[model samples]
Target: MGSASLWARTRGPSQKAHTAEITSGGIWTVAPQLEQERAVTGGGYSTPVGVTRAEPEVNVPHPQVDAVARRAQERVADAIEQLKDYLAIPAISCEAEHADDVRCLATKVRDDLSAMGLQHARVLELDDALPIVAADWLGAGRDKPTVLIYGHLDLQPVAGEEWSTPPHEATVVGQRLYARGSADDMGGWVSHMVSLGAWLAETGTLPCNVRLVIEGEEEIGSPNLERFMDAYPEAFEADAMVLTDCENPSDAVPGLTVSLRGLLEVELHVRALSSDVHSGLWGGMVPDVSTSLILLLARLLDDDGRLAVGRVEVDEARRAAGADVPLTPEIIREGAHLLEGVEPLPLRGTSAAEWMWWQPAISVVATTLPTPAIKKNALRQEASATLSVRLAPDQTAEEMMAVLRSVLLTDPPGGVQVELRADGWAGEGWLYTPKGPAFEAADRAYVRAWGRPLVQVGVGGSIPFVALFGRRFGDLPLILNGVMDPLTTAHGPNESMHLGIFGKAVLANVYLLDELGALGRDGIRS
Candidate 1:
């Protein structure tokens, strides 16, 4: 029987990619307000280095930005300390046991935002889900544009992962803070806090109206984020948004994520008999389901072991853009933690960025095949393997499934029964081209802080919230940035955030608000 079905689990990290979202340029969503708590206050990239250009420059540093930037620089150590406090909480959202930790972190953050003098800081609670922290400072007035800063308070679980230091204890080793959520999200938003706090301390008000929507379930793919958006839409409304949960191409090069691969998990199964049979009696007579399962899976890959189905053709412009990302095998080896001798697969004709961020890929995440502990001298009755597919940006789960079914369900070895099911996760990929003045505003801020403009980059990993944001607010400016570099190792052991990146992100944020503020409410979306 060649049947295709889906056994999707919409939430949880163990069964899905429980990661947060994207942006280097930025995104904006204008939604109707919903019921929410009140304690008000709030407010909230960039270029390459100083290559003098002939074009008239629009992103000059704001006069007040210098004061804020200086203050942020002074607060770097304190900022890292704050990050340490957040990392101490084991707020892994995927595990049920850690749900309280998630709420505890949200409560702590709500209290901190209130203490920071934001007008309204409160923890938003939804039934059957963890709490979300929402706050804002609207003192900048109605004319100034409101910039929403988004980040997650939850973390990826560190169980079974080896670490150089205690995973929950923030350890500074050579200017990098090692801890889960340090860079993946905590550092990304804390850097903003340092800048916003400095702005408040120096001027008593933000350069623009600002809103904070720190999520509690981002590490679990933000499964209920939409429900939160619908029930508390006020929490997400803004003239422009700065999504701070992406990665930098390098510590030296600030990346504005412009594209991302989506995620889809499918289980491929094969059965030759109702129950196990003695290998001595049936090895030659019956088809080995385990062997057949392996053979069928092989059909999904080219010699490179990459997913061969549902491939998309990239235009020259996209290829040229991917070429700009500074991804090398050495960087991948170091970032991905490949052993000394194990090398990255050959790039073949495509650039690493294209192969990673723009193409489909596959990994065998789980299998029901025999293990050493359960080895037996019998022909297995059935075998199954769960495949995690990274879909190309703009590719949908339905499109990928169609291609998979065509390749895997055609001819069966020994005509063994076969079935395919989407195990969990069918999150869409994101592809955005930043436009309007908000983007120019971002480039100016990045140039001032990083000494270079933001390099548009793409994320090979999937972030469901990003695609959701892209769909809900694709028309406006949404700047996606983060404090992560290749070496941060988010969702892995010894995750660290480069302090230098943290400092630069703080400075850039300081200038970004100033730049966006100058645009005015009408000017930003215009």
Candidate 2:
């Protein structure tokens, strides 16, 4: 399909040329040709600290970088073969039984890094936790900035029956590669490795110092990341970071993620009696735990699907940031892959994109009760459910959890006892504004590789480690880009990665590193 057709199919109808200007809150407004040139030359981009320079511009034209990247693109077949070997390992970190597989993948990654000529490549062993691979190349002097690349080596579990091809075996159909981790993350890891390998093969040294932190526990909400960070603070220090685990809005246009929603997992349990009681014997006299839990859950949302626990207000800055992003019902339908009979929720006084990316939302992830197959007619002794809440940028997990706890405990259903407990893996939301030299360099790199302006967007999902990195690095520019497109079907059946986009992403990273190196040479701080 043509790029325009694919974009329309994936992101709804196209908007006017002026609409793009409104989406960014007026931070970027220029003619098409001038905008592309400014993005390439860093002419009109602003820095947060207001530091300006008139030094000689380091210009590596698109053709020069593309030539080097084309050499790497020539090896796409080899890269795919190696990726198949990597994907063959069932590195599901959520299940304890797959711990060995996770370690195997970590060792493989470390070996690959070593083969790439990195000076230091080893796995950091955490006590009772999956191993994390940490590698660095300090060939570039301290005068140059060090760039950290972050990705995950683990993946979600797979069901064999649900997939058209074997999830663990990389199967290529047309231009797409089908595998468990092909798009969600292994594609990201491979992209980094390919770029670095290409640079090292073409030239003996990299443009800047590099460090990699590939973790094995990210699929499980990164439960051990905090412990890892606390234990070794100096290992992760870098001047800038590029997290290679996000999805593009469409196949034609690359997206740079600017924000991620925070996550809070909660479990609510209620008990009315010590044991299951006969409903017919005491149907009128005894309290129903199921009914009580149902009533409590009903209070969680009002008629409009807004959370009723407390007022959900959007941040002024975030609202402006998402103002002109076109998110029609058709767009949501295509993006979400809604079933034929499934209808979307009513408009909640905001665009669907704004509601999804900038506002708070709740979903009852799972519920536990007696199965109808067992034919149980007794009143259940206890009822429980799992609630997952996605918090906006300005909201913290603790504050939202407090509001939910207050509402649940306000009034009891006569005799039923209620208990609410957090799942111990709360993650704060993260917001980043594109400014300074690093962001501009990334924008130029994206345009150079894709021939289009990069889309600054927000992700409704949460990556716990991104927020952790922000806290640890504190204002260091974070470039969030990835290879997966809208139709990659990450974390779902028949997950695949488009080879065309994957090759382009590798080329884009090559350009990104070159651009950042030029800025470092010019004495840019970030």
Candidate 3:
């Protein structure tokens, strides 16, 4: 039954590959239809519906773990209410106008932590940046491994017109709770909090010591996190870190994001004249800044829709790693929730999964120009745009920036003045082999909670702090786990959390903490 469901989910009616053939480069080149079958029954692949090529060798199930998970499940209503209260704060960290709101949200988090029995909870202020909430429960003693729990208190701005319900007002429709930050991290935060609260209520002690660091600026590329980490390194010290800020591939599947693409945001400005000129007077004589900027931006992507500038070529090993866990086109299409009649980018010989997770891509995110609402007959003197580049795991920000500069600035159209500036933040991508006691515990916990093996996946989005945490904590095992599903629509209209999965996620975290505590009891260090 599981195999049939896996195949059905992966194989659509139209996509059919020619044959199942392996190339000399170790990349699997199969027709789309055949690829779907291979993905379902092939070795090394696991699906959400308990379908697997190999039996998952998990740790012995903790006897009391089920009871703890059930307790967490029983508190779903309390968790939802707490998450609703959290989502009520319009903590838009990217906008400076919401500075006080963000601070207030941080304060609430600190107070909640204190209420949850962490007596040392306090707000840490760093220079002019927003405050961060930090607290620790060290009651489990030094023999147990200390685990750091990281989450964000900030959120993306909501588009009022696009939302069906008020963005700050949590409303339940079916099993989903509609609100801003309901899924893209406030839900995750509440999940951890509820799990901890349940454990404290039932046992009065955690299996491992816990340290919590909830930041207020994760949405803005975590601009102040590195400085905060540098100043207070000891506060974040732990054997393992659980970053509850990533999304699962689908609602049913539990995922561990093993890799994340880095980000480099650039602003390109072009000037052909000193000031706006009348188009009627200089229509033929003067070069249009908008035209020049468009041409310059067009050079960034080739006909294949791949990055022409700063392209990072994936080697054989990387290709093998990506291909080992292939994402079928059907899965990609469903996960993306693409608009009707829209298709994925036309990158030949590359699957949708590879293009998204393993390959580097560039996008023109925003353009600063005169809008149609404010139309003018005069030719603008300058045209500017914001470009975002998603770098692969093997690529470095410095090297890619140099390549981009070389391509964008080498030759100017009509000798127009072109200036490309690095827009303040550049985060390096992170990739780590999933191993160690923490990973094993996570595998067992996920299986126990979800009734399936955990799927290892890669996210194209950049979480700047994940890489920073690795650098600060000296390569501790970091688990990128969360409750958001593909339909959560985080950072978009009608953002929500699937309340059913949200409850399951709390249970999973409960099991995870229990499993980690077991490792501590055995004195096994990752």
Candidate 4:
């Protein structure tokens, strides 16, 4: 077959080629065959290094290791099938027409959890909120540390034009798994299930007590999770919480997210006139709303792309998130896909790295305007633009919203009536210091599984529940480990999973349990 056809043909990782080598520098590199070709030819490729034992050949054939790896792969395939079934049920919380889809997905999750041999698995039913799937296995001991695993099962609505294939169908192309929720939470959630199954199949028991809480309304800003946290604090109290819904660094680096930026989405509306008037007669007399909107947005940031809000500092953010790293420029250009001939935007007089990880960003998500194709040669009287602001650490959504509103409306651009209001928000930042036995166990497991140094990083985007969970369970460390690459295009169309990393993720979780088991129950005792 031609290269194009081969690239188009979807195959599982077991069928793909691989190369394993221990470099003189002591990094054990495992390059999957599918990625090797791409890496040599400038395709996005990743080789997870130092996570496994040094080996000269790819696909180690030790019976016990091979058995465990094969079991993990099989579980991934089974979960892919399960994911396809789950995605087919469109549980769009934003749409009122698909309420049944939400329930159906909940029922499926409950059933899947039950099938995993957990002692108790049931949906946490609510009157108006989508039910949360709650499951737990205590095993034979009362002293075992109970680790709570959290993820969302619902997905955002999909549009046909936005996807290369049907977004709901789990399309396997080469070593990639493509679907709407395939990468976001569905894929991440299913990974937890499959990894648990591998542990069960290989050892006949989990490394420690496990409680799984998968929700259905996370995509809709998780308006009900805080209330749920309050009502069932007992169920949530645990040694640690494992969040698989966070972002990973670029494909090259393995990272544990230590912080996240908050979000504020606001709409600024401007009225230049009471009604549309003929441009020929009113062109010079009336101000244009579109022009005013652009000018207003421009004032939010200085020429250096830093927020101009009083007392809002972007340099501190850059320093906090480790903006002095080498991957800044490459990762930014790769992540943003800037227009051709457009240079990377500088952040506080530094490279894109400083701008991306450490700095705040203001993006115009959408603008309401009359279509020009049907233009009636009339001057627009009113217009609105939605702005998405990424707040730095230590900043509140309300504070940022107020600042944006004040800036947009405080000084009127002559001839325009302007108003600003908060449209949506995912509240502000958090920093995680992983302490106690659980964190030590996680560190050991990651090292044993991947043979690499665990790098601590900060996610620029928001995970709304991270901060909420911090307040609910004081002093308990939250472990933010995930497999979504920066270019994974999560929350967009044609999302995919890199099978190599997915397999490694399974091993990491398995080893995490093993390390925790060594800590005994009292180590995690609060």
Candidate 5:
């Protein structure tokens, strides 16, 4: 499907007109036709920010940014093409068979980075882990800040997902480039690559020292990122870091990620009988494990389908920040691809940002419950469901598990052998408070590039690598930004990155380098 399908208009009490733009903080206005033309052209270029935006929201233009922006614009097509080359490999990290593909992509990136005049561009290997690609250029000298850029090359598994376009072919429909890794990551770092490439090509050097670290297994929750970090500490040394795996609030408004929810998976197993029992014969006499399982799961949720137990109260400051996020029901409906007549769970006096980014949520990801293929009028011996929990920011696995166990283990419907076990991957959440000259530098850079200062935002999903970065280098400024919008559909089928976002992101990176470099190491360090 194309933009026509992705942005299909819906008229109802829950959704607004599809043609709307969120220009002000937390406010939306009906968009004119001119706003639609502020998108990508066939050549993968964007309408100049000056022309599309009518007037600048923040004008902090610098002499260096002007030249860098031009060079970056000239190479937007190359960046798009480079992203396609990388996305085609299908370097899925979760499957055993695709291990070689991950290695191949890592090597290709290493060589390509080497070609960009970076020093020591090579693939890093660990005994039992996938590879990571690294390179750096520090010739800008010690006085300038060293900026480390992070992104992942691995992709979510697409074997069972339906796609409108070929998942790996990198198709461009409407204004987006549709591919598995287009926005989630490849586009993120590729924009940096193009920015760095332009700096090297136009002036023969970057404004600041730069290091590139591309992980090969992020989609698998970055299980070995800490191991890679431990084994190669020097590769991570930087005065500041630009974590490129994040989202913009809107394609029109850039977002600086300030928080991320954690992930924890738990499995619930119910067993009442050793063998299958005919449901009709034992309908009322026996306590069916399947029915018991359904009831227990229901107990964990509220009428709106949110996790009822262990909900956290938000402070006024955070609650106000959440209110400033333009997460109207229309945006949520379009972004989530909800079917007609199906509405998002009621907000229930909470802002979407607060509910999604700060509070806890749960979903049943997998279960041993029978399907039609195994249909029989009988109760199976046991049933299990693997629940994926999105924990509150700053919450730990142990804390959420304790709360879950307290509710799930007490008062069984049939007194069946109920077992609640922590299962699958688990990671802690991160909450950061950005302050310093570095954030000021970032705001200047974004203002020049996007005509507006960066808006603070939080992600609902867990990024293990991000928490690792926060834990390891909390003292340094961590500027998280990327080329994703609500419609990116990352980790899901039909994933795409808006080409306009890609183009603007490259310029933002260009300005970011100049602004950070001007701050000098000493100024940034404090």
Candidate 6:
């Protein structure tokens, strides 16, 4: 699909257009084009603070990263060469045709991780389910905390006809890389591998006792993760988990995601008659089930777009913890481009910051119905709808689902057979009270790496695993960080990351290890 008209105009300048001289490791001269644009627009640029100048002594500037970048640069040809081979083997977990391919991908990933210095890296085979790849590096003693990292290797189902480029081909044009899994996760996974390689190559040991777990069922709602977690509780027990799944709020504001909205998804199916009656024959006499279902679904939210369900409410106490910071109206307005010409949703008559951080919203994500053209002159027998209830930290998934089902079932429009099938995944929201050593170390590292202090924000999306990890290791100081920009189109087509932002991410991760050590040595251990 073509980009939005506004996005086409605001695609922004290329790196060369933004900077004149690109330095290797540290400081580099700003491009004249970018300087002029900044001067005219009065928008400041953020560069990694002290690293503008090169530091040549200690590390090799991570040759692995260079090699990876070179490989990425040749993505077009590589994608072409690998296209048929990849697409021919469907890896859809839901389908039997692709099961073997899924297993193969798991093995390939484990082998890659193993080559990246984790000699013992291997995949954990879950019976009757996709496998999860795990690796461990115990560089530190038990006195030091272990950092568990999580990611996934699965891709959503891709029908053959829906593309201009090959589905499995890691195609690159100019600077944009295109592929089925390139952006959703595969690219991100590759980045972690490269980063790990860089750290191992330079330090010969990880900064902490680390465990890496990458599952293949994330896109499938992680059907087996919790079961696996239950079977082996100690496998992922760690001080922190670095989830690379999320995105940074904006390129300028490198943020630490403070919270993720809980998810409550359900499909409400309404069935009227078993057989189709011609709409022409039954025009005025019969009640259209699709119409009734639509009307009922419309009442789910108030005029303000907030969920009218009783369970979806803000937690004042938790809200006060992060409270709304300085997110501006202009930022929210610009971000609502997802709605195109439609006006932005009224978020409880509050500032974008407050609404995003403290409010719950209900979205009718999808409703399935036969084509109007295919409609017989029949009273529609059934129509099914899906709703995504994004809950605030105060709400529970069970409570939200209960409220939703009750509201729909309470008053049905007469003869329609409304069967609300509350089926979908529910992951709880999290609000961590940042304190003690890990937070302090992370804060210091972020501040030192970038000139600005870390901005904590709540994301509209959920990881589903963070809450699980939190429950597994109560009171563990979990830190979250990432480099994907807010408008990076992560799950959507044309997903890309800012190179400069990624470089800063690497520097941040590198310093984070040292900061953690400092925190431990200075008596912050609990």
* Best-fitting candidate, scored by lDDT: 5
- What order do you get sorting by lDDT, best first? 5, 1, 3, 2, 4, 6
lDDT by candidate, in order shown: 0.80, 0.74, 0.75, 0.66, 0.81, 0.58
Candidate whose TM-score is highest? 1
The residue ranges of model 3 lying beyond 4 angstroms of the native Cα positions read 1-61, 159-161, 230-234, 315-338, 521-526
Give the per-residue lDDT digits (tens) of candidate 2, residues 63-114: 3343456555655557878889999999999889899999998998899899
- At residue 59, candidate 1 shows an lDDT of 43
Assess every candidate by TM-score: 0.89, 0.83, 0.83, 0.81, 0.88, 0.74
Stretches of candidate 5 off by over 4 Å are: 1-63
Which residue segments of model 4 deviate by more than 4 Å?
1-74, 303-334, 337-339, 347-353, 424-426
Clashing pairs in 5: none
Model 2 Cα shift for residue 191 (angstroms): 0.7
lDDT of 1 at 456: 77
Clashing pairs in 3: 16-33, 17-31, 17-32, 17-33, 18-31
lDDT value for candidate 4?
A: 0.66
* lDDT minimum window of 10 residues, candidate 4: 1-10
Mind sharing the TM-score for model 1? 0.89
Candidate 6 lDDT by residue in tens digits, 283-340:
6777788888877887776776655665344555444423324444455555453455
Stronger candidate by TM-score (3 vs 6): 3
What is the TM-score (0 to 1) of candidate 2?
Answer: 0.83
lDDT of 5 at 131: 97
For all predictions, the C-alpha RMSD in Å is: 12.9, 7.5, 9.5, 7.7, 8.7, 8.3
Residue 437 of model 6, lDDT score: 56
TM-score of 3: 0.83
